[model samples]
Every structure is written in structure tokens, then in C-alpha cells.
Target chain A: MQPPVLELVDLKKNIKNKEIIRGINLTLGPAEILGFLGPNGAGKTTTIRMIVGLIRPTAGSVKICGYSIADDFIRAMSNVGCIIESPEMYKFLSGMENLRQLSNMDKRITRQRVDEVVELVGLQKRIEDKVSTYSLGMRQRLGIAQALLCRPKLLILDEPVNGLDPAGITEFRNLIRRLAHEEEMAIFVSSHLLSEAQLMCDQVAIIRQGSIVKTATVKDILNTETVEWRLDNPVKAARLLKEKWGIEALRENGNTITAAVGENRLELINQVFVNEGIELRYSIPRQNTLEDMFLDLTEGDEIA
Target chain B: MLRLIENEVFKIIFKKRLLIVFGILLVLITAFAYGQDNSLNRTKARLAGRIGITASTDWKKLCEQQIIDLKNRLESPYGHEEDKPATRVRIEQLQYYLENNINPLDSSAAKFTTQFMEQSIFLFLPLLIIILAGDIVSGEAANGTIKLILTRNIPRWKVLLSKLAALLMLEIIVLLMAAVISAAVSGVFFGYGGWTAPVATGFRVIGDRLETLGVVNVPQWQYALMVYGLAYFVSIVVGTVSFMISVLVKSTSASIGVMMSALIGGNFLSHFMSDWKITRYLFMVNLRLTDYLAGSFQPVAGINMAFSVTVLSVWAVAALAISFVYFMRQDILV
Candidate 1:
């Protein structure tokens, strides 16, 4: 009976007569992680900007903790923490000082909480050094520390791991999962790294050209079965599968055919190919990855 | 809001902007004090060469001689009609100094403090204020830290208001630095002994005539306070205008450039177009607010202290309104 931690209803935006975001609606509950995936110029950043109050929406509402962003901005924003783009801090100040500056803005934050977040992000080693001297990975950690200062109920991260190493990325994924599951916080993350998202996200929403084209659970997306056929004369094999067995197979390459048939059908499919005039090399069942689903949904647009 | 202002003040302090302003004041004040001492010694030497040993003790003779020369120039009929009133005022000032037994050439730290502010109000003081206030808002935008602040739980107007308050506080500090540095530096050269000296003020020019009814003599310290007060007013006006420009422009260097050009261009416009009636209404033309207290000559015809203050107040208010409205409604695309 509790309201969702973050909600967007009929969100829209227009810039100089060009529609940038067209009626985006989403809801995130407690302990949920939604990966917002989109190609370049697809309104991903624009949508994040609107949620953080950086850009005004043409028509719609962003509500946080049951408070409308437009009418109760301070209250709504108090419940949310975000990094819209790159995590930029005051370079002249030490990392600890930057955290102190942000902590001062909210009344609920305390000195103990600051140190806790610093330890949480593993920035305690170099926290007292000037941010200008900190590496990109360190700055990213400090930014996450700043966002966690007020114990926000909803966290929004845009390309949070763009500059991180593989180990850092894995560590960040674990931290995000822990935050969501243990703290019961709703997190919305926009990322171009689909493999990372596949490991970190519970659900994925792929957007294209200012509209949500697909939204599904990661488990559902990865659970969809398919059989790939590696054989001679893929064109003839595809036609034969469609005509004889009423199956639609996609010609992925010159000599390979993929169909949404279960793994049990692979043996029969191989037999069909052998009985026919086609020379069968092999047949294997494969699970769709988030990358594969993302490419299929976006039609290979440039992912930024 | 207090925390916000504290944040702003610390940011400016860490940026070393106030230190730069203080450094500039120290260097310029020292140079001007040295120049003044040299000029005063040169005048003393010239007077000693013309007269005998009595030149140092007898200032009345020099005053009378200068008055006589001015009177002769007034009667020669070779002077421009428009310049006659200023000459007559200078002659009257000399005669009044003689009557009051006050030597016009007796320089002191108090006198230097007042004089320095009067000379710097129109250009130097305003430039220092611009350096302090020009990037309060735009610097954050340029460096990408504006998003960090704007994404916090504070309202947009509160953020801007805190910045303005911090700027005003720093402007006061700048004026204080100018006064203290000028007085301190000049005292070492001028002997620091004129705080109780009498100074004449409240002179008015009404239609090509010197109006002396309002003239009164106050102590040199009181006179310095009035001059610095006027300078502070001018500083606030300049600071507010530049703060507004900071909001309108996102790049710090561009904001500073725009304000600098407008200020310098206004100075030139006031000189080249003094005859234009609209020129008197410009805030830049009225920046020399201390001139009214010192009873200096006016280049343009109809502006008085009340008129200048009104013009400046209008400009400051308009700029503040524009800044708040625009900032509140802006998308902050950067």
C-alpha cells in the first residue's frame, strides 16, 4: 500500500519545436533496479535531466515518495539523489571537502553519515586529497558517496561506470545490488554497457527515438530459448523449416539459421536438415543475452 | 540559506579571488602613495626656490599669490565662457582656505584615503568589484559543478540569493581593504596627522554659478567616511550588475568580457557624447558618486547626487529582477 519510490507519468519534452521525450511512463518500487537502455540521441539523458529538475518537461509529472516534483520540489528532491551526467565535483576542494559541501545542503545528513558513505564507496584511502588530483575512478566513487549522503530513497545514475575498470565495474555492480536489496532503495540506471547492465539490473527498458520500445525482466529476456543452425545452404534450410514445419528461421549469416524453437527441437531440426539436401555442420541451443535482445530491439543503432 | 552562503564564501576564498583583489589594492595604493609624496616634495622645492626660508612657514603668501594669478586669468577675457564658473569656484576655494588658515597643500593620510576613493570610484574600484563578482554564478556553470548544486534539495532562487548575499559581503570587504590599505600605506609617507583637520564640502553648481550656501567644514575623518560611503554604494551597483550578467552568460570569461566592455565603453561614451541628454541617465556616467561630496566639476549638465543615486538604484533593481526571473525559469542546459 506504500507508494512507489519513483514514478514518471506521461512525461514529455520539446526543445525548439522538436520533441525530445514523447510520453514516457514508468514506476519503480522498493528494492527494484531498472536499467534504462537507449541509443544516442534517444532521449535517455533528456529523461534523466527532467527527473532531476535540470530540464523542464513539456507535459508530465515526476513524483518521488508521493510528492510531485513540480509542486513539492524540495520535498520530492529531498527523497531523490542523482548524477545526471558525469560526476563533477569541486576540483579545488579535497574529496572529503566536496562531500562536506554536499552534506551541508541537507539537514538530515551528519558527520558520521559522511564517513560511513566514504567507507561504503572505498574512498577512505584518498578521501582527503584534492579532487583535482583524484583519478577518474576515484571521482566516480566520491560522486556515489555524495549521492548517498542523505540516504535517498531513490537513486539515479547516468553512465555510472563509464570510466571504471573491470574490477571497479564488478565492485560497483555488487554495491548497487547490495544497496537495492539490503536498503530497499529504488535505483534507475542508464548505461550503454549492456553486459554490465545484464549483470546488475533486475529489469531492462530499451528506448528508441523518444519512446519506450521494450520493457521486460532480465530473467525473461535471458530465458527465451533459440536454436542456431550451422549448415550448408542456409537459405534453402530456412525455406524448408518455414514450409514444412511452419517455423520461421532468421538467416543470421550466409551459413547459419536461428529460430525461436526450444532446445528439445534441435535434434529433430538436425534430422530435418540431414534428411533434406542440406549438409548439416552442427546445431546448438543458445540463450538470448541482454546485448542480443538490445541489438534486436534497437536495430543496431549507435549506442552511446 | 546561511549554509549556502557559507558554501559560496568558502568557494570564493579557496579560489583566491579576494586575495587577488587585496594584492591589487596593496600594489596600487603603495605606488599612488609614493607618487603623491614625490609630487608634494617637488611643490615644496619649487616654492622654496621662488621664495626664501619663509616658504615653509608662510603658506598664506603662496595662497594669495595663486589667487592673484587666478583672478588675473579671470579678467583677461581669453578664457572660455563655459570654463569661467569652475575657475571662479577654484578661486573662492583658495580664498576660503586662506580665511580658515588651512593650508590646501598640507597632505595627510586621512586626506589621501578620501582622495583615493574619489579618484578610483569611477574606474578602479568598480574594476576590483567586477573581478570579485563576475564569476560567482557562471564559473560553476562553466566547470560543470552547477549541476551538482542545482540537483540538491535547495530551491533555485535560494541558491541565487545566497550567491548575491555573498557577493555583497565581499564587496564590503573590498571597500574596507581599499580604505585600510590606502590609509596605512599613505600614513607612512604623509605623517598620519590630519584626522582633525577641517574639510569644506556640500558645494553645489546651479546654472553656471557656484552655490556656497550649503558648504560646511567637517573634520577630515568624517569627510573620508562620506567619500567611502559613496564609493561603497557605487561598488554595490557595479557588483549587482555584473552578478546579473553572470547569470545571463554561462562562460566565466565571456561574462567578465561583456561587463568589462560595457564599463569601459560607457566611460568613453560619457566623454564623447556629454551633449546628448540621454547620456546623463546612464549608470556608468553617474558612477562618480563621490564627486558630489567633493564638489567637483560636472561634465554633463543636469545630474545631482539625488538624480545619480536614483539612476543607479533603478539600474540595480532592474538587473536583480532580471536575474532572478531568468534564473528561475531557465532550463540550465549546460
Candidate 2:
């Protein structure tokens, strides 16, 4: 069997006696897009750095294409391409020249491959101009071009769409999806934008305070059902539901209550509310999104 | 490794750093050549006034007259005892020139090239090398490009080794540029006609007395080669040291500043503390390796070619070892 394209087992990092990345375990396979979501200072970048061999992990292993990063860094990194923080190229040289410089470092990368990646990233128009003159989106595209030059099986991008415009973000999302689905490349992207992750990744890992609090398939996260009620006495309804049906509902407002229950229980909830002398104005079944799960799992920490 | 080095060299050239070094050399060499021409004319006029002869008189007569003046000074009671050995060496050098029919005072392109290197080897040439090598690694960190390169599949040691190789290659180029510019610029003024002239070398100092036991005469071009060879060696040492600073420091300006201060401060320390026994062990004091070949008076006694070269080699090796070990294990947090 083909090994996973990227794997992190029991990963941990301590910076100056402070545990930064606490015991992260992750696996990504070909044709998979995993979104590494975390708040600021939540060790998202640190974990990516370890995977790419920029920072050594305290006591864990990062295996890329079945090769251990510590024991076989060259072979491990050869199968991986990454943009750790920002896609910084040599601004003094033209984009084409920058690509050429990177391509020169690896013998497997060819001139034709460089041109193909440039075209793939839609950077052919400004590739001949100095990067100092290129816009942020153009540089991001160029960074992607550089990452794709080696035909890597594992691609890691950190905040890939941070400086991109809405249109550029959509285009980047489409490109990433295509790369994952069409080329069967395993992409591990980190971002603080929950909506972006919701729209992009197949699997989402939400990290908080150096640990992975939740990891789930996007389909499973979105499939989670919650029921909302508009009633006269939300506090009474919340208490009564906990007392009777043993369902914990959040008092969203004076007239609203929401609980993590499916649509099948909505009628029963309304019937009980009506029977218990509580007026039920309306009720609706709500679909939980990745954002709701992320907020709930992270407990409303600062995302950025 | 070769591809990595090619990439480094490509970046250096495109950055126009070599051009800057070349420009500085051009401006300084031209000024020095012009100043040297004026100083030579003034010396000829002074000689004409002293001997009651025209400046165009035969060079052999000038040598004889200079020898007589030196001999009289040696006989005079007012002469300092410490100055006698240097004066004696000068008198013997003029005598040798006179016997061999070589005009020691004649200015030429080859002589000017050798002289420029002799004067620059201690300080000026090292400064140029620092400017070239000081930012090779730190500049990448400052610009955020270090992450790009270090994340590649190649090992960090290979990357650093390639950078060092490219820097050494450029150091040699800087020396060549210095020699070529000095020769070409001075040739316009000095007529470029001393390549075959005999130059006296290998004089030594043995206990406050001039020692000429190893003295030999070689053509001017050969002497220039030896002088430049020493200059190249000094340049490599300085380059390696600055390369270490580049790896240790994360900012280009800071790296350059630290090395510049160390170099200038070393000069000051050497001048003020030459009497201290341990000062002879400092690499800065030994930078004047060419002076030993010229048989010049030692600022700090008991140092020779082998001693200085050994000190410099040790410094280069230590700096390289520190650079590699630190860089290999550095976290590269930037």
C-alpha cells in the first residue's frame, strides 16, 4: 500500500520551556485537503515549520512520503513543498529568474517544469518583471508556482490567501481544489479564516492552545443538526428541555433557544413546550457549519 | 553543490554587489595613481635641489648621491640609534640597485600595483572583502528569503558550503580586480615599463640589525605576484571571518557594522598595544603579511611570514567551524 503523503505522529514543541505545540497527530493522504485552523499564537505556524524541517520538533516525527524527516530530511523534504509564512522571493530579480534560481537547487526540476508551473499559476504575464513590481497576489501565485515546480506529492501553504482579494481568493481556492482532486496532491493549509476553511478543506483540524481540540471531516461537521425555537420564555424552555428531554439548550436571547438536536426532535420539543404552558411562536431546524463547530470548540478565542 | 553555488553566484551578480566593489576600486585606484604621480614628481624635484643637478640627471648618479647622504647621516652623532638599521637597509638597497643598474626610484605600473597591495593588505583590502561577504547570509534573513532556501530539499550544510565557496571565489575576484585596476590606472601615469626591472627582496631583521643573508633580486612582475598572492590569502581570511558574522547575525547592516568595528578596532588595538607580548597573537596584527616579504620594520617584534600565516589560518578555520556548527543547528526562526 502507498503510505500517507504526509504524517505527523505525537508532534510536540517547547520554546524556551513553554509548550508551544502539544502532541499533534495528523495524517494526510493523496487527494485530501486538510485545513489547519487555529487562532493567533496557537502553534499553527510552528507545526508547519516542523513538518517542513524549518524547526526541529521537541519529540515527534514528521514523515513525508514514508521517509522520516529527522533521519532522511532530504528525501522527506524532496516529496514536500511549502510556503511557511509569507511567499518571499528575491525582489531584486525577475519572477522568472526567481523560479530559475529555485529550480537550480534540485536536479529533478527542469526548465520545462518551471514554465509549466508558471503557466499553471497564471503568472506568465508578469513572470518576466522583477518581483519588487509584482503585487501581493502575483507573488502568492509565484510562490505557488515555486512550490509546484518539483511536482511534490505534499504541498503545505501557510495563510495562502491572507493578502489576496476576494476574487483572487476564489481563484486560489479553485486552484487548490483542482490540485488536490486532479493531481491527487495532499495539501495541508493553515488559516485563521474559518469561512475560508469551510469552503476549501475536506478535513478540518481546529487547534487551540497548542493542541488539536477537534479533527473531523467537513461533511460530518456540517452534517451536525441543531434546532432553534422562538418562544415567549426562553429560560423556562431551556430549563424544561433539560429537565424533561435531558437536552441542553442554549438561551440565545429572551425569546430564542437553540439545542444540538436533530429535526426529528423539533416537533416533540414544540409539543412539550406547548403542553407545558409555554407559548411556542415558531421553530426551525438549523444546520451547524464549520464556523459554529470551530467557535464552539475554540470557545470564541481570537481567530486572528 | 555546484548548482547551489551557481545560484548564489547568480544572486550576487544580479544584486550588483560586485559592481559596487569594482566602482569603489576604480575611484580609489585612480585617485591613488594620480596622487602617486604628483608625489613622485615632488621627490624628483627635491632630489634635484639637494644635488644641484637637474631632475633628468642619470638615475645612477642619484643613487650614489643618496648613498652618500645616508652614510653621512649614519656618521652624524644626532641620528637616533633605532633608525640606523632601517637607514642601513636602505643604503644597501640603493647600493644593490646601483651595482645591478636597476633604478630603484623609477615609477612604473607593475611597481605601483605591488605597492598598492602592500599598503592595502593590512586594512583597505579587508574592508572591500567585508563589504562583499558581510551580507551573504544575513541579507537573506532580513528579506525573508532564508526560509525559502532552507526549506528546499538540500541539506543546510550544503547550502552554507556553497555560499562559502561562492564567497571565496568572489574574494579572489576582488583581489584580481584590485591588481588589474591598480595596474591599468597607474599604467596611464607611469608608462607601464617596469615588468623586467629587478626588485630587491628577502631582507630580514635580526636583533635590531639589518640581515641580508637571504636577500635576492627578482623581476618586478614576479615581486608583484608574491605581493598579490599574500594579499589574496589575507582577503580569504577576512572573507571567511565576515562570512561567519553573516551567518551569526540576522541583519545585514548589523553584520557589516560588527565586522567593521572589529577590523577598525583591531587596527587601533594593534597600534596602541604593540608592546604587549600577547598582541602579537592577534590576527589583526598579523594582517600585514606582505610587510614581512618587503623586509619592513615590525611594529610587534618576533613575527614572520609563517607565524602570521599560521595565525590567520587558525582564525579562518575557527570562524568556519563556528559558522558551520552554528548554522547547521540553528533553528532559523526567521
Candidate 3:
């Protein structure tokens, strides 16, 4: 219903005669969390960098909040807050002072906004401490606090959870959800953790070798399609389901069979298997996970 | 722009190394004042002992007392004509020597004394400039902060402009401190009242027409102003050159090292190039613009202060232009 907050129109980037990104197009709508998934050197950082105006794309344009990054950089960048790679910080300054310095980049940022973001990132207690003394998680929190300083309408983070521990990652996930839900901000984050992306993102865009392989809603990608089943013997189960229910299924492994079966047909397969005296180890229709979808889509090494 | 400039200035003042440099200047100025005072006292004592009188706080009073002593002995009721000639001759000889041979106790020597008291330009001011100018952009690049600052949506030129402006401000601040320190220290020993005293360094450089360049007469304060202007110009030239190197090298040590070598090498080259007409055009040759004050080396047989200023000016502008263009286009990948 609303126009996309961020758009990449056939973006192509070439450096020293080597193409990095090839005709990549993407759009991030308002209040949506789009996970940019890619392996190392897969152009995730490169694409995010172009969106933040860090590097000029060899071809095409990136628009932030309807303003082109090249045509109107000030206006476009004024509303976009980003953390590319590891957040660069002045280590000698206090965490709060780092936020204060970044806050000065935009006139709209106020003292109250700084305080709010510091607390939002759960760093209020340690905000007065020098950045050099901070843990990796605290530093990332401080970086995010700075990014949120100007109350940017769109937030772009590259590997925001890379160095965070479990607790820090959970807090970061909650904070990002709050920003998108309560503040109505569009957040585009790049991460190699597909499970984390599945748990946190509303939508996910899979990138392989600098190109987007797929983009879909988390519900559609994980919950609504392609049921997988685990049985005592996948080959025997596949044969039994094919003969009795007239349903075709593929053997995934020694004991796992995946089938595109309707909801009603799931009961029929289980009943036939039970009558044949086949002991069921795990026979429920398996919901597809982000990791499974990722492996299914990408051809090369799956994990980044 | 003003706020940006203010922020830049704040960054400079907060740097601990720069603060220490200023502190060192203050200590040196204090030590110099003490040494000059001790030397003045010792000279007064030595001269008073030769005249067979104790050194007094007031030297003119001592001379007047000597004249009255001679007059009293001449007008005494027990005095003989024989005693009169000897006393009169003694008084006349002393008066002639005092008037002709000895320097009048005046503020005229303040300029020469102050210069001798303080470390010359070759040592002090250039080192001060190096403390700040050496790290202008290279420090940021070396620390990996350039990428952060540049990515903040501000134009690259604005960042460079802020840095250049900040360094210039720091230069002005340091020069001003030096001026105040020099004045205060020079004031203590010289007893502070001959701002208009003529200061002539006894050195001379013979140019075309055997033109003696050193004896140009100017008021002490005016002479100080000339020195300030010359040093100020040199600082600008150094700042611009160091800034260009800062942009090119991307390491603080390299930028400072290259500029220092250039600075030292420039002085060395000028020594041999006093007769080289083409060497007069070298940027470093004009570095000692104030040397023309002390009747030191002139770049060419006929070159003047205006010619030196022109050479330094051209070099500074060219360096800044290169810095401005290259920094805006740098990859900033770090």
C-alpha cells in the first residue's frame, strides 16, 4: 500500500574490470524488516554500502525514502541511518559522547533522542564509560545508538549480530523488532545466520554470488510450503505413500522423505504406514526452515 | 560552517600531545627569562667593578654621584690647584668613556637581547608547527577514522576544509602564544619600555651594488611584526605541504617524516644556493624570510622580501590545490 522506503534499480558495480554486483534490484517497504542473506564477499556489504552512499555503484541508482542517493545525497542520507561492517568509533570518547558526536551530524537529533536510543539499545548504564572499555556487545550497542540518533526512517545494518553473544543477539533482535513495529521504520540487515534471520525478519532476500536468488515472506518461505517427513526407512515410506495414497515423494536421506502433499493427504499416508507395521520415528509434516530453503536455493557451499 | 569549525578546534585542543607542546613552550620561555636576568646582573657587576664602584640598581645615579664627588673635591677649602687638574682630568676621562665607549643603558638592545635570549626561528617555531601540521589528515587515515567521517553524508571537501581550518587555527593559536611568551620573557630582562628602540643585528649580506641588507632601521615592535609575518607565512607553507603529504601517504609518520626531511633539506640546499639564481625559486629558500631581518642569506643577489613571499605563496597554493582535488576522489576503502 505504501511506497518502498528503499529501492535498488538494476544496480551494477564493477571495480577494476571485475564485476561485483550484477543487475541487482531490490525494494524495502516501510515498516518491513528485510534480511539480506549472503556469504562472505557475496556483495552483501557492497550493496549495503551503496545504499548508504559509501561507495558509488559502477551502474544504476539507489534511492532512500524516494530520493536518489546520487542526485540528492544530503536529503537521501539525512533520513538513512546505517552501520556498515564493524562500526567505526572514537575509542577515547565515552559511549554517550560517541552518540552525541554522531547526533551532531543531523540538526534534528536532540538530547532526548540520544537518551532514548541509549536506553533503547540497553546501554544506558554503561553509556558514560569510555568506548575503549566496552565489550564487543556494548560497542555494537553504542554503534546502533549512534545510528538511531537522527531517528532515521530507514536503518541499514551489516552483520549487526556478528560479534554479539546469545544475550546480546536476543536484545538486538528485540530492539530491531521494536524499532520496526513501534517506530514504523524500515530495517535492512545483512547476516549469514539464516536461523536468526528466520526468527527475526518479516521478509528475507537470499543473495548468492552478488545476485538475489529469492525474495519471499518468512511465512511463505518457512511455514506454507513443501512438507518434509521423517520415517524409519525413507525409500520404503516413499514407496508405501506412492502406492497407497497415490502421492509422489522424494527420499531426502536414509530416513527422511519430502513430499508436496496436501493437508488432508498427510493423514492418509500415516494410516497406511501404521497398518503396514512400519514404526514411525518422526512422521509429522516438517515445516521448512530458513536453513533448509537456503540449502535448497544455493548451489555452492551453503554456510558463509 | 562556524559550528563545524568550532568542533574542529575542539578536537585540536583536546589532543594531549598538542597540549604538551604548548606546555613545553611555556617552560622554555620561563627558563629563558631567568637566564637573561642573571646575565644582565653579571654584566652590570663586572662593569661597576672596573670603575671602582659597587654595582647599584641605578647606573645613571652612580655616574652622577661620580661627577658630584669630583666637583666637591674641586670646591673644597683644603683643595690645591694640583689636586684640581688631576680630579678634573679623572672626571673628563670617565665622562668621555661613558659617553663614547660604553652603550647607553637604554631599551635599544632589547631586540638583540630578546632574540639571543629565545631560541631562534630555526629551532622553535618550525618544531611547534610540526607538532600539529604533521598529522592533519594522515593521523585520521592511519587510525581508520577517515572512512567513518567520510561516510557520514558530509562532502569530502567539507571534511578536508574543516581539518585545514582547524590546523590553521591551531597554528595561529601557537604563534599567538609564542608572541605573548616572547614579549613577557623579553620584557623581564630588558625592563620593558623601548618598543620603538632601533634593533640592528651586526651581520650584513652584500648583494648587487654591494647593497647591505641588514642595517635597515625599523622600530623594535615593527621589527617584531615583520618577524611574526615571516614566520606566519612559513607556517602556512609548511601546513599546506604537510597536508598534501598527509592526503598522499595515509600514514602520520610518513607525512611528518617526509616534510621534516624537506624542511631540513631545504635549509641545507639554501646554504649552497646563495648564488644559484634558480634556487631562489625553491620554496625552502625563502623559509628564513626573517633572516633578511638579521642581515643573513638573501636568496639571490637582488631578491627582496617581496620575492621570497611570492615564492612561498605560489608553493602553498599549488600544494593546497592538489590536496583539495585528490582527497575528494580517494577510494577511502579503509
The recovered share of true contacts, given per candidate in order, is 0.85, 0.92, 0.31
| CA deviation > 4 Å runs, candidate 3 | A1-3, A224-284, A295-304, B27-124, B185-194, B200-216, B272-282, B299-304
- TM-score, chain B, predicted structure 1: 0.95
Candidate 2 versus the native: TM-score? 0.95
Q: Which 10-residue window in model 2 chain B sums to the lowest lDDT?
A: B203-212
Evaluated against the true structure, the overall lDDT of model 1 is 0.89
Best by TM-score: 2
lDDT of 3 by residue, A109-148 (tens): 8889899988888887898988889888888887788788
Local accuracy of candidate 2 as per-residue lDDT tens digits, B187-269: 99998788988888887866556677788889999999999988889988999999999999999999999998888888887
lDDT per residue, candidate 2, A64-125, as tens digits? 99999999999998988888788999999999999999999999999999989998889888
What's the lDDT for all of these models? 0.89, 0.89, 0.74
Report the C-alpha displacement of residue B224, candidate 3, in angstroms: 1.0
Q: Write the per-residue lDDT of candidate 3 for residues B188-303, one digit (tens) a residue.
A: 66666667765553233443222333344566677777777667778888788878988899888898888778777777776666566777787766666676555544534667
lDDT of 1 at B69: 76
What is the Cα-based lDDT of residue A226 in candidate 1? 83
Please give the DockQ score of every candidate, comma-separated. Answer: 0.82, 0.83, 0.28
Candidate 3 chain B lDDT trough over 10 residues, lowest sum: B206-215
Instruction: Work out candidate 1's RMSD over C-alphas.
Output: 2.5
Model 1 stretches with alpha carbons more than 4 Å out: A230-247, A252-255, A262-281, A300-304, B51-56, B69-85
TM-scores, each model vs. reference: 0.94, 0.95, 0.78
lDDT of 1 by residue, A165-259 (tens): 99999999999999999999899999999999999999989989898999999998888888887888998898888887788999896798888
